[model samples]
Target: MTYRAAIVGTGGIAASHIAALRGRSDVTAAAAIDVADDRVHEFARNWEIPRTFTSLTDALASEDIDVIHLCTPPATHLPLAREALAGGVHVLLEKPPALSLAEHHELISAVDSSTATASVIFQHRFGSGATALRQLASTGKLGKPTVTTCDTQWYRDDAYYAVPWHGTWAAEGGGPTMGHGIHQFDLMLSVLGRWEQVSSMTARRTRPVETEDISAAVVRFASGALATVVNSVVSPRQESRLRFDFEFATIELVHLYGYDDSAWTFTPAPGHEELAETWGDLLTGRPSGHAAQFDDYYRALAAGRVPEVSARNALHTLEFAAAIYASAAQNRAVSCTELTSSSAVWRSMNPGRTARAAASA
Candidate 1:
């Protein structure tokens, strides 16, 4: 079945979603929606969308949209996702899916009750290098993986945060840990099965943002592999990198934002060079990006199954982020299950209680 897709928000991110959807034969960019009438119409014209709606209410009511690409902010995801699912429409959610675990669980419920499905845009996991690592580890070619790392260091000037929602916990969520590094770290969780605990620290530094501009954490995975995670928007030389140290070989991937085969290196142990050759031969040329993942998501959707980066799968990544905030705020280590609804730290990852402080003022 060909999917009739609609783009729900026409912003900077909408470009990525549109560009990827434009050339797909199995999907049609059926409609475009945005609050700005003039801007949305122009966006639709440029993208060659045959239909446009200024209001989501009107768009959902008028268009028989099979899937909705939610390129809006984190704060809008819960309602947009829920509404789409309730309408039996699948959703292609942008990263951080929700601000908290509670919201994520709700989306899962909506998904369970309907034929529709929802998946986050953790496109980095779709890359050939990452796919290779996951497969190699699963096949025992990488030996028992012991150490993994995710580091995202990029600069975001004050001008970058001038957007009204840029820095707020209620809107943009929690600074770099939530907004910037989640794409890379989500890819980390994709390779490593599960995380057991985390210890983290966060600071606002110089960005003048409500949430932290830098966050550092150490994560212990269920597989006995320990990972170091660092998120920052203050660095000058930007880079996104991940490394895996297995009993037999050390695999490394380094790039900014997205990576291709050119960014990955497979280093072999003296006796395990054969294994390296085997790994290098797989997933070599595929690049990590939105289009690669969308192909997987749409194929699974057409098959009537939960797609890659499904809500249930992405919850673990969200839990890890929440655990980081909880750990950083309390200055202690936190277990994965500690961020349940009953936990005070589950209260939306906003540091310093600035909102609460101002609400009482």
Candidate 2:
């Protein structure tokens, strides 16, 4: 039986969802929905989607869509996901799942009360290399992780932020730290496990936007591993890289967007030369992208289980992003536990600025 999906928000990222659905015989893109009528119609025509709607409400009422792929902006994720969950339809959200941890927790509650499940798009975790890395790390084949680095240094000019929502805290959330680097660092967290603390700094040096164009953070994982993370849209040299230095070996991946096994290098420590052969045997050549993740999601649905990158799993990544913002805004290290609903940063990423403004008034 084929599952039907609706691609909501016919934007740049919606095409990736459409392509993933098209590649799978067990799933099909049945409809397209967007606030703009012309954009929705054009997207449907371009992708040969069967139906189109100007709103999710009309689409949900009119079509038997099994899942809604929300490629909308950060601000719309919570409400759109709630709407989809209300209809008992599964939801696949683009990353930075919700604007804040509070919003994410609310969505989690919505999922708990609904018959359907909600998942965020962190496709990198489904990559074969990432899978191998996680397994090796979990089983201690890589030995204890000591140090790591995750960097997303890509160039996004002023024109990129010219989009009304691109650099705004209200819409896009928090620039590259939340929007762009999330995919890479989410992959990092997937391999490294729970992060305990974060110390960060954000700056808006180049881009003329409300949000910071570049951000840096030092993260401490539960395993006592320390990681330096850098998310930047102002760098001239574009690269997405992650390096894990374990006791036995130093494994690294360097690629701008997506990577296959070739992009990863497993360098064994002096006495552990044989581990390189193990790495070669374990690495699956499958590349990381939407198609791989969609396949896994469908399989989970078939088995009547929650999918990878489920709301609960995504909450950790979102919390990490929030912690970066909170740490930067508050000018101190932020613990994951401090991000409860009562926290000021729970509602806004730059709560310190708001507090300072209020105090001056």
Candidate 3:
């Protein structure tokens, strides 16, 4: 059975979701929603979407929609998702799910209280190269992970931040660290295992916006691995890549232009012969990354089982994000538990506060 889907935001990122959905075999794009009426018509016309609504409430009222893909800005996700879940629609939400872990919890609670299946989009988990690397890391053959690093060196000009809510704390949440760099950050955590602590630094390198345009962090994992992240929108050319150096092997996945199919290189450590055999299994079809995640979510929904990428699992990523911010602010290492606990600092740093204050000023 084909899942009927509706997109709640029709911006540039929404176009990617529409494209991915259009390419999927078991889903159909049934509707599009955006506050701008002209954008709705343009998107629906260009993508062949059947129904268009300016109001999310109206789209949620449609009985045909089984899944709602929320492509709205980070700050707007919680309320819109709450409304959709209340309307009995499964939700595929975008990253940095909300402004804080508190809001993330509220959304998760709402999903648990309803029948809708909810998940965040971490599509990098779907790449063939990502799968091959993750398999090698998971097995003891790769020995133990030593270091992993991710760099998101993409360029965004003045015009890119010209949109009213582009760089502020409240509207967009954070800058490259939370926005552009998060895909690889999630990937790093997946391969290196859970994070035990994080220390970060953020600065405004290029844009005059309210949020920092660049950020970097060093992380220590529970398994004694070390990792670092560098994110910026100031690079002259665009590049996205993740490299892992393990005790027994080194694997790197490089994506040249945005999020298309990527290329990879794997180098086995001296003593690991058996681990190299897994590359055949990875290339043939093991399904451990993004595609595997998507398949797992679909199967669970069909069989009345809980999704593998559950709200709690999604919360871990958010907690890591919060730790990054907290680490930078406090100028010291921050624990994962400290980041997820009830705290007034994150609520005060909502980033959207600047936008709201700007309106009043």
Instruction: Give the number of the best model, judged by lDDT.
Output: 2
lDDT of 3 by residue, 1-361 (tens): 7888898999988887776665667878999999999999999999999999999888767557888888999888999888888888888888878777778889889988898877887776666666666676666677788888888888889999998878877787778877778888887776777899988888887787887788889989999988888889888887887888888778777774334332666677777665556665676443333445556666777787777556667777777777777777778898877753454335534434524555798
Q: In candidate 1, what are the lDDT values of residues 248-286, reduced to their tens digit?
A: 999898999788998998898889889867887896688
Query: In model 1, where do residues sit more than 4 Å from their true spots?
Result: 351-361
Question: What is the lDDT ranking, best to worst?
Answer: 2, 1, 3
Q: Candidate 3 clashing pairs? A: 125-289, 125-290, 126-290, 126-291, 169-351, 169-352, 170-351, 170-352, 171-352, 248-269
lDDT of 1: 0.88
lDDT of 2 at 16: 88
Candidate 3 whole-model C-alpha lDDT, 0 to 1? 0.77
Task: Give the poorly placed runs of model 3, Cα more than 4 Å off.
Answer: 23-25, 256-262, 284-297, 348-361
**Over 4 Å off in model 2, which ranges?**
353-361
The clash count of every prediction, one per candidate, is: 0, 0, 10
Clashing pairs in 2: none
Per-residue lDDT of candidate 2, residues 79-108 (tens digit): 999999998999999988998788899999
Question: What C-alpha lDDT do the candidate models reach, one value each?
Answer: 0.88, 0.91, 0.77
